[model samples]
Target: MNKSLIEKPAGCSSSILSRCRAAMLIGVSAILGSSSSDAAMNVGQNLDGITYYSSGSVFANSFKACGAWLTSPVAGGAWDTGFGDKGPSTDAAFVMRTDGYPTVVPFTAGGVSQYVHTLAPVYENGTHRLYFTGKGTVKYSGPGVAATTRVLTGGTVTFDVTVTGTNDLAAYNATGPSLRKGPSSWYIDILVSNSTDPVRDIRIMRPGYNTSGRDTFDSDFKTKLGFYHTFRVMDWLRTNNSPYTKFANTNGKDGTGIGKDFYSQGTGRGVSVDHICDLANETAKNIWICVPHAFTNAGMNDMAASFASKIGVGRKVHVEYSNEVWNGMFQQATWVAANVSGANTPQKYGTKAAEVFTAFKTKFDAAGKGSQLNRTLAGQAANSWILDNSLITAGSLTDSIAIAPYFGKVFTSLPSPLPTMDQLATDTYTIMPSVRSWLDSHKTLALSKGKVLLCYEGGQHYVGTGGSENNEALTDLLVDFNRDWRMKNLYRYTYMGDVNSRGVQLFTAFTLSSQWGKWGSWGSMEWLKQPIGPNSYEAGKEWGIRDWKTNNP
Candidate 1:
């Protein structure tokens, strides 16, 4: 699940009393927030249609980042676990920082004795199999990293070992001799350690890979995620809690000649806007961007100008300011509450959103792409009054009002003895009417405001909350429910039916894919090419979305 899914439950805050009351009245609960060959031909038509949700962030365990060159953020210290700029407190035995290089040459026994490491996505349990290609003298130990005499002298090293129980990367150990002299490209197919040991630099560091103007994104990533009409990059860009306050602080260059060598991952700022635009171009999809809340006016203008100049000629751009500013769980909400002067949080968000919209519009107009720009105002789905208040300030500048009308929140806090899969399915049928009512009111509101309604994020919100997620039995039940055919039917028939009938112009689901654990089963499919069964469990939410799209088209 994306970071957005880890937010506090709806109505948890006092500011949203109305939302809670509205949710109760409608029987809706908890807030959560597809295709290939045939998808390409319908690109133009799909722009006004549904698109896939935003891609997940670049993490060691990220399904999106797997099979790619980049891994998790580098850690540096004596024990091989330090992050950011924390200097080594004890003897500096080893160090692996950003720029994909270790300052230290050799790994000491003490340094590599016990250390944290990065693991490939979906390699947490069972037998781990992977290949490494690089130039290094290293040894590995631990359940996650197979114990082996590692040798990477321009040849691939293979690891085929079974790990019992949970494979924790933090318990890995490593020992290595001095790295080979001269520049060498270190690429690991797996066991990319996110540690402070010298081995980390060798495994995670490699230069001149993406600079050749070749495909930077993983082929699997493109094939699995590229079919969307528009790609929302809220998570991809790391727009929430953004560290960028100026254009110079960004990772990639802007304008026509956007730089090829962008530091896409291993930093909080995330993939640069230039690279995101490149992704949109490569996939032949429209782009949806979330402006960083911390960006200055000058910085925003620079980003907007770059987006205007670089986005593909025919593709559209959907612009929103930050993400979920109404939710206090995010920094953007606090930022608006403090920085932007308004009567309330909604008004402040609206004011900032209008500014952001105007900035992009100005640049798009100057670039003769104004018609392709769609400015969106995102509001809480359960609370129409939030939209009403926000639109009062930003309606004239907005093209659409976006909401995340997810279902299954009521299940998050269900009592002990969780409902059986069949019972859960039956209960799901009861919730759609309220959900449909919620959509109808929002659609009505959007129409009254002379704007189309858009679903920025929406899907089944069946995950537990308030520590209920930690209940292994409940987690099993929820995961099984998502896998059931009933879940797919709910999405294909009930959920999409409600969305389409309400006249939603565009609907993007919550996420693409991620591992289903205690965090929440937010992924439509756990991973790309995860076998959909002839059995009901095999065909999960992704199949449902595919069926809906096929039928709707």
Candidate 2:
């Protein structure tokens, strides 16, 4: 529910406020030494420490009980997001075949035929819920076609869209299109071109995490990644077929086992470590767990002792505390950014992040837990063979580093308009060297202790127009990215997981292709089929890709 509106009580004139302040000095929560119109207690002012702002006030009689005012903050608490695609009110685009010439006559809002330019169009989603309307049509090139005879009735067409951000023309396809969830957060995609031509080949994908301000299904997805649940999925895989290694959390706690709680009972809002152990004990295979954040020290120690006492400690379950703390790749940035004054305040977050991690580590060691007690830190600040003076002086902290060489293009060119998908990819490879230099400088720091450096997350983006026949480059790019970066301890951002298409490119493709079906296959047995790409029919010879891969590949 939205927070209640706050307003100053009526009869709160200057004299009355002074008296109220005097009487409530000790009764009030704040003990500040200020009392004026601009003071925090005044009307339309943020009361709590939270940063909320009030809209312009409507002058009302101060003599009345009170004047209600609205206070809406950018983000004050849990976000209540909307669901489902908003369908357009217009009819579907009409397919016309006249005089032996076939053409697509776009529907217009007004009942009239308008002329328009011709361009070859191919779409990803088969279920065209949205349609474009345009007046006039170019003459067909067929031999028997008559000039100036071709006409298209312009009107509305059914399109599913939720307008967000400045780019209103953009819409979310089940395929990859950067999108956000909530009241009206615009989609976040690297603009390829500001060209007048309508964009095609632009692929939208959902994000694993919405650090880029894109909406995401992470809260739901996190449930699947639970230490125990992921193990079940992995076990199902290995027992039935493939041989993949299991991943462990940073604390070195095995997928299955008990861990003591240093503080209160393990009641924090996180997937339970014991749950993973229970699954593993049930004979699950290929279980992996990577707890993104370090548990409080007391909790960590308790978990370690509990785990060791039950199953005995080993390397099967691994844990790394300080991994990629400084990189823009991980969600750690979100926690750091939250405490920061603004996105531009690098020093604010940078120093605070180190302090938080340091406290976390001290508690872990003091509690006495885990087989590998030493924390592994990654993404530390470095310059050549020495630590960066700025980070060192600024109090950057971590034991090891996890570097993710995520070098890609934000755009073909930024000063002017954007570029197309093809142009975006070309620009990525061209800008790769700057990324290499950054990595090399850090690698020089390896001159000292063999600090752990793991590639925690890595992948390349695919931007292209057209269908399977024309967009082969996308598949090839994915194959190459996997081949190059598939190293030990590496975890890809996605493994075909998403209920909605927002920031992730692959899942969006599946969504846009009508792969989920008319009702969205969300709760039905068919929902499992949503992950299959458009080529599922040809590749799986079955409706569901998961089933197809399970049975065939």
Candidate 3:
């Protein structure tokens, strides 16, 4: 189900690769060419267009800014990810006991038992309740020194929270310890047991990052602005009979007909335009919303109308259908195959896409808002074949086409001895020419029909497929080897998107935040929960944010 960029079997291993060296390179799809360089810190051998160098600085040549794909918030004070919170004490999820010298022992602050640290911890879906019975006061403290203490009542108290970005815990910065401190960038809840007697103040709180000397590794906790999703257990959800939802608050029944939030009552499975607007409250900017093709016509209308009413007029609302429908990993792809007639055929996919778009557009038109010409982007597969039966089917309904300019395949179909990360980076570059040619031809085709091209998904896929190529050790080694130039090529692709200024209209990167993996660096924010510090691949996250900010379309 993982997007198969290469045709290698999932079970193929390095041993098999070694034995079939010559067979590996046969008939691979490539039409590489050398590209002229404009970067200031060039460091690679340009052989037929791909740069073989293993290291270099990110392109400072005025990066092409685009919108970051916001999917989930990643903020945890843990060392490992992918397992959620099952690691050692470095776990993002933690439990604190205020009895007898801190039995849980979450942190070691100058020999004193500190209870908080910066973490992109999980606050599962729902309310974090507090039950108070006996009389007792709870105190919250710690950052650098742990001096401040906020008090609250015991019996029963509630706090609403959601995942956002956590600020970096720099040992150099000051504002309290700064360690373990998760500002408004995070959503937390406090739960206590119900007691008959007046219970003391049991506060659920967080501390800043530890700046002192321990600023080297990940502190207990930290955070930034509100992101999308963060992995957390749902234990935070409380049953208080109040039944009031946090963000939407459209609990139980509402006279307004519309739910408090977008997905609260929508026919689709993901967030809606109003949901993005809700996010707008945190981001305070126009947003790009990817609507699922599965949405009912009614849901699409509500989403469209919601965008018009909430986002205000003239605000940019970049919209697209289900992401990568060509890839069967997602339900949309499978749904199309089983539902849409003839969509199973490669030639009929575009037709199915166009049909999907037209159906959504119909609802949008009924809403009497949103410029399909300027806003709606017809999503396409990342594959080279741009022309599809759907293009003709949509006809005038399609004005802009969206494609993912993703390249940099590492583990797919490599030569026998296996190339180094440097070679992988170089090989990725060789792919640009073919993509450029495709884009150029597509531009002519689009412009002929008064349409434009855009990149709905953009990032690096330079990872191995299954078998030994899927070995975690190899993955780590490559991550270390290509850390520098890998990013360079990533930015390189962004620049490629602007080929002759007729390339991509909006380059929406694959995501805004994620954990370690091929797609880890793809986010504007690293799955900050893992990795030691900024020295890790997460540095690319900053570069992503910078690039997005540069060309703020």
Q: Write one digit per residue (lDDT tens) for candidate 1, span 1-553.
A: 1011111255332111011111222222122111122321111111111011112222222212322222222234442333312211223443433432333333343434323232223324444344344454544443344456665555555555444444222221232211111111112322333233333322221122212122245445566555467667676665656656655432122211123332223234455566677767887888777888878888779889988998889888989998888877677789899999899999999999999999999999999999999999988776788888999899899999988766654444657566876666555444545555666678889989999788777666665656675676776677677777767766665566556656677778766654454445555655443544435535378777766666767
Worst 10 residues of 3 by lDDT: 45-54
What lDDT score is found at residue 320 in candidate 1?
93
Give every collision pair in model 1: 29-409, 30-409, 118-193, 118-194, 533-538
Q: Which stretches of candidate 3 lie over 4 Å from their true place?
A: 1-273, 281-284, 342-368, 372-387, 413-418, 428-433, 489-502, 518-521, 528-538, 544-553
lDDT measured at residue 82 in model 3 versus the true structure, 0 to 100: 26
Residue 60 C-alpha lDDT in model 1: 25
How many clashes (backbone N, Cα, C below 3 Å) per candidate? 5, 65, 59
lDDT to native, each model: 0.54, 0.24, 0.34
Ranking by TM-score: 1, 3, 2
lDDT of 2 at 8: 17
Question: For candidate 3, lDDT tens digit of each residue in 1-553?
Answer: 0111211221222210011110011011222221322321111000000011101101110000001111111233433222211112222223222110112222333333233221112211222222222333333222222233323444444332222333332111243211122222121111121233323222222222111111111122222322222111001111001112122212212111233221112111222234335434433434545444444455445544555566544444555554445554445556656655653433354555454456545645665644622444343433334344446555566667655444455454434666665565455444444545555566666676677665554444444554444455555555454355444433433333243144444445444333233212333333333332235434453453343333332
**Tens-digit lDDT track of model 2 for 1-553:** 0000011111121111111000000010011111222111100000000000101000010001111111111223212111100111112232212110113222221333321222111112212121223333323211121222223344422223222132111232335322211111111111111112221111111222112121112232232122111121211111111111122222222121212221101111222344344434433322222323333444444444443333323323333332233434334444545644533324443354354445444544454433333233334322222233213423335444433222222111122333433343233333233433444455545334444333232222222222221233343332232222221001111111111011111110111111111111111111111222223112121123233113221
Q: RMSD, model 2, all Cα superposed?
A: 27.1
**TM-score of each prediction:** 0.69, 0.32, 0.52
Return model 3's CA RMSD, one decimal: 14.7
1 or 3, greater by lDDT: 1
